[model samples]
Target: MPAPFRIYNTLSRTIEDFAPVKDGHVGIYVCGMTVYDHIHVGHARAMVVFDAFVRYLRHREWDVTFVRNFTDVDDKIIKRANEVGKDPVALAGEFIGHFHDDVGALGLANPDHEPKVSETIDGIQAMIGNLVNSGHAYEQDGTVWYSVESFPEYGKLSGQKVEELRSPDEVPGKRAPADFALWKAVKPGEPAWDSPWGPGRPGWHIECSAMSLGDIGETLDIHGGGLDLVFPHHENEIAQSEAANGKKYVNYWMHNGLLTMTSGQKMGKSLGNVINVRDALSQFPAESLRLYYLQSHYRSPLPWGPEALPEALAMLGRLYEARENAEAMGGSEPVEQVISGLGEDAKKVFELGQGFTSRMYGALDSDFSTAQALGYLFELARAVNRLANHKKAKKRGGPVVAPALAAFASVAETLGLMAMSSADFMAEVKEKRLAAMGVSHDAVEQLLTDRRQARADKDWGRADEIRNQLDEMNIVVMDRADGSDWKVRLVAAN
Candidate 1:
């Protein structure tokens, strides 16, 4: 049987126990990118959050079918295509490719179904036809608009009464301010499909409703997107789907909070404060970006700053370092025997490691509290580091730290962090950080060579000078009994 978990449902505004529509199965639909441009860090939050959530669900043995849609025929795509002298569909396809590249670099798994609006026109038109037949929608001047008044529960998701809401735009054919377009009448030079309402395209909100219904079902086990989507996009989705299908649209509404700038505005392309995922990944390892997002609770606004990735990378480095130290221990004794001999630090590590999974599950299962889960991992890492410092830990402490090793492996498997071997992680960090700093490996290696020769010649003055030079370049030298190695410092130099 799959383990049970609770999640915060945006509709109910409470954390509720998750019950699948079918036994041990979850049908989830997350609103995906608009595909007009490369996804920014703000967009990546929803991507990473849902990705991690799905990973955790699958890790716990839940059968999940995840569907995320692409708004390939949106107004933005047409406008961008026109600005760039490209066909709208071609522009969407280009950015969809870019979207895949960025998320792939971030190590996100592809959704089970990536339905595109262009591909799902049949379903969109069918749903609009249903809404019209049911009197939930009306057509005028070749445009179809969903009648918000038909669904008394229109504002149930967003809590805005239809009477109080102002129309988003002063379009001519709309009968009411709150009523939104289901089918947009074709405009010249824009992509259009033949529909009963004449040649037109699906509106922004209806694409999700229709694609989700076609991919998942009338009712979804979970529907997720960014918190900013709650008001209009998601609220309209709920209105149109329920009014059309006569079934609850989504059982659970899950929304990830936005990435906010220091000035207290959400990072957005419209706000002109967006940072593209491609640029962020160019300077940092993918896991650093993942860790930065996971460090906060999924529902909390994550503050974007200059040092976010660097600080997350440093945090990740500590976990990796601790895991490496724990892995280096060697022993064949029983864990209890080693713990008894190695003292309190060993006992603490053993206890924390043994209790890690339950604690982590407790945090994650309760509203997917990644922040708390990461806090537990950090606590376990600290304990392992303390145990590694014991004199007998290296040769006789493997048995004592075995559970800690397992804990580290579990975190890697569950959270997608620490999945890389210590060597691979260090290499990636060096490669990326060095490139970001515009420092060549040969240059750093040559300096290390000079410093090694200086030390060999017993010239402390030259050795210290070269070391200072490397330090100026944000490189740290580690002198072991076997020789010397160096790394690009994880944090910025003061």
Candidate 2:
């Protein structure tokens, strides 16, 4: 059996115990990108949240089939193609390739099935045909409109009522203002497919309804998207799928909160505040971006600003530092003996490390509380750091911190964070962050060499001067017993 866990269901507006459609298995469908442009950080929040959720389930030995779709045919794609003088299909295809590149750089695993709206036209038409046959939809002037009134339970998902709702698309020949399109009549220049009504394409809402039903069955184990999609998009999905299949649309509705700006508005492309994932990956290590998303609860609004990635990198550095310190200890003495000799710090590290797994699981199993799970990891890290401060820890504390090392390994396997070796992580940080800051590596190295020579010549003033110069360049030099080293500073110099 799969490990038991609870998830917040947007449909029920409460956290409920998760039970899959099949024993030891889950079938999830998440709404994917529209494919008109590069995916932004706001879009990546949904991607990373679902990716981590699936990772945790698989780590607990559950069989998961995850499906995310592409909306390759849309009004936005057509508009963008027209502006760029390219075919709409070709433009969407270009962005799909870019999407793969960006998400791959972010270390996201591909979904089990990536259904596309353009390829799933037959499925979309079939479902619309069913709704029309069952009196849930009607056709006029080669356009099919879903009669929202036919489904009395239309408002259940979004708490919206038909009388109180106005259709965002003001197309001609709609029976009611609240009724939305199932199939749009093709214009002279738009893409079209042959359907029962005419040569028209699927509407934005119906493509998801059909693709999800065809891939996952009549009812999905979980249906997920961003919180901004809860209105007409998700609500229409529920109406169309349930009305056609005569079954529950989804067992649980999972929605991740949007990334919000400091001005208290949601980040969006139209708002011109969007940061593309590729642009972010160019400056920060992929794991740093992952850490930024995982630091907040998936259901909570995450704040975005200039300091977000920098702060996340700093936090990641601390965790790696603690793990490095724990790994450096070299004794084979029993942990109890080391604890007795080194006192409270050693004992606390031992206790926290041994108990870390259960504490982490307890947080993750209840509502997938990543924030709480991360809190426990930070607490363990602090304990290990404190124990390392003891003078005897390096020579005689290996056994004492062994469990702590195991705890760190567990976090990597479960969360896809800290998977890189400490040395590799530091190297990546230097390469990317230095390039981002426009600092040349050879210049920093030459400065370090000059500083080393100045120290050798007993020129304290010159060495201090060079140190201050490097500091201005956002570099921090470390003077150690073995040798001197430097790193790109995680925080901006004031």
Q: Which ten residues in a row have the lowest lDDT in candidate 2?
A: 163-172
Error of 1 at 169 (Å): 3.0
| lDDT per residue as tens, model 1, 1-494 | 99999999989899999999999999999999899988999999899999999999998999999999888998988999999999999899999999999999998899999999999999999999999999999999999999988888888888888778765688788888888899999999899999998999999999999999998999999999999999999999999889888899999999999999988898999889999999999899999999999999999999999989999999999999999999999989888788789999989988998899999999999999989999999999999999888888999888877888898888877778998999999999999999999999999999999999999999999999999999999999999989998998988865
Give the per-residue Cα lDDT of candidate 2 at 305.
93
* Model 1 superposed RMSD (Cα): 1.0
> Candidate 1, overall lDDT?
0.92
lDDT of 2 at 487: 93
Q: Candidate 2 on 1-494: residue-level lDDT in tens?
A: 67899999998899999999989989999999999999998898899889999989898899998999999999999999999999998999999999999889888889999999889999999999999999999999999999989999988988987777655776679988888899999998899999999998999999999998888899899999999999989999999999999999899999999999988999998899999998998899988888999999999999999999999999999999999999998898888899899999999999999999999999999999988999999999999999899999999989989999998998898888888999999999999999999999999999999999998898999999999999999999998987789998997844
- Output the number of the TM-score-best candidate: 1
Provide the global lDDT of candidate 2 against the true structure.
0.92
